[model samples]
Target: MPRVTFPHVAESYRSFKMLMEDLGNEVILPPRPSKHTLDLGVRYAPEFACFPVKILLGTYLETCPKGVELIVTSGGVGPCRAGHYAQLHKKILHSLGYPVDIVVFEPPRLYPLDFLHNIQRLNPRRMSYRAIYECIRRAWRKLQALDNVEKLTHKVRPRETIRGATTRTYRRVLEWIDRAYSLVEIEEAERSALEELQKVPQDPNRDVLRVGIVGEVYVLLEPASNLEIEEALGNLGVEVERSLFLTGWTRDNTWAETTEGLTVKEAAMPYLPELLGGHGRDSIGNTVLYAKRGFDGVIQLAPFTCIPEIVARTILPRVSEEHNIPVLTFFLDEQTGKAGMTTRLEAFVDLMRRKKAARRPA
Candidate 1:
């Protein structure tokens, strides 16, 4: 039984672990991204590689030494450099004498046979078809549950009368979700978690700023990568809504978009018709949607040098101007500091508040 691990990107790891374990594979969880992880990644990864690549590489470097024999990760398509990350990591690790086996899961549209084969390879016990289906169903449910909790926390955080209460409750609930084994247990954890969050005292009269977060999926989802931007905004009495979630991203990439209402592509079509790779198109589209939805402002977060986001950054100003919304873009890397981000967020919130107040009839 080869020890397997994947990058720790937000709470997606819980679902990934559940799937692997249900398939009878040994799972090795990596430590959350820290300064040491960044240092190791920077030491090995190319200087110009995007921030996520470095962080992911750093995570693998930290985990592989724990006798991990197989590394499982997803891949991308189009112009985003993420499509090549698995190969890049494999080469870098092999050169350093790790010699781990890396299995990259590209979109099924691009490599159907390869994707199925890779999944089969992971099942050491060769689980039956029904078992595998059940495993996938359970894992998907877990991912959706985690995402729901995240959305609830965002709403509660901004209105909470007790500072930091929402954040603490969120962390505790995540642990409960992670510990859940069956679908019934997962739902119980999710329901109990939501109830707990709603119990947090909140100010009904609080006039909070509503901000929409858009940018590269990695930066948008990963707390360490984005300096915990969501929590920071929530603490400052701002309600944050992200354009991307793990389940949403997985659906958009893996299957055809069957969402009934306004799709991200339709929203962005007026601004950017073509798919620019990664979440770039989604960022543009989501900003437009947010503007129409009357969000106070939009913040775009991306790893420095990410081509897709760089393209989105260029066009965001036009969207901001035409949509009558204020858009702020932050390019993050190893050099990004928490204090600087917080200061900017505070300023942005203040700006939004003034703008909202000025619109009210006397």
Candidate 2:
């Protein structure tokens, strides 16, 4: 058994922990978002790598130094740099003198061929079928619970006292959920957490705007990576409805890709016949989903050099044309600053506020 470091603590952490523990390996949760982690990534990774890749690389370096034997992560391939990160990380770690084995779960390209192979590789110890099934069930539960928390947190934050308090509690609940023996227990825990969250008092006058944020997964999750985009939106008197939280991504979207590809024909049929790479299909799906859900607007955040999103950029215009949804795409990099992002966010919020205001009956 190898000591593992699960990077990116958004929503999938618990699921990964359950699966790894089922295989009888010790797992250490990665440190929370911090400058220390970001600095490690910025200093070690290539200049053009996506923020998430850099952060994961930095995490690997730190965890490997602490004696972790294997670093398991999902890798995507296609016309995108995301697919190349695992190999790049492997070389980077080797060059830096870390002996960590990089086990990458290949993302589905044409179908789920690579995905199944990766799953087989992950369970090399040949654990019993029942045990494996249990692990997967636990993982799925963890994802659903975490995603529910994320969705509800965003919906309730503008109406709560402490910002992101629900998110913090959800993390603790995740660790506990992995250990729960039954689904009923998990449901009870969620109920209790939501009840506690509702107790937090908030100002009724606060403007709550349901703005949809779409883009790269890292930018959506890592506050530092995206200059605390969600908080900025919250402060701007708008309720931020993020589109790329990991729990929904891993459980709904990623899991679907593992099989014959889950089709969201009901939601985004007009955007079908187009699958760019990385999250191109998801972007289109989420765009339509957000629009139909009555979000004020959408913000697509991706690294400056992201290819899949660039391709998505073209498709989204057509989506906007069809749905009359306003989408603002931001390309981020090392040069992106908080002040700049805030200014743009403010403008976007102002536009959304005026648009919504016009629709209300006087």
Give me the candidate number with maximum TM-score: 1
Residue 238's C-alpha lDDT in candidate 2? 69
Off by over 4 Å in 2: 107-126, 161-182, 202-207, 245-273, 314-322
Task: Report the lDDT tens digits of candidate 2 across residue range 1-362.
Answer: 66776576555666777778777777877666566776888899988777777778777766777877777787675566777788898888888988777777764565477666656656757887687777777667767776666566565666666766655655565565556546677777666666655565667776688877777777777776777777667656667766666555533643243233434433455665655666766677777777766778888988877877887887899998788788888988766777887788889888888988998999
**Lowest lDDT 10-residue stretch of candidate 1:** 250-259
Name the candidate that leads on lDDT.
Answer: 1
Assess every candidate by TM-score.
0.95, 0.82
**After aligning candidate 1 to the native by TM-score, how far in Å is the CA of 24 from where it should be?**
1.5
| Count of clashing pairs, candidate 1 | 0
Give the CA lDDT, 0 to 100, for residue 340 in model 1. 89
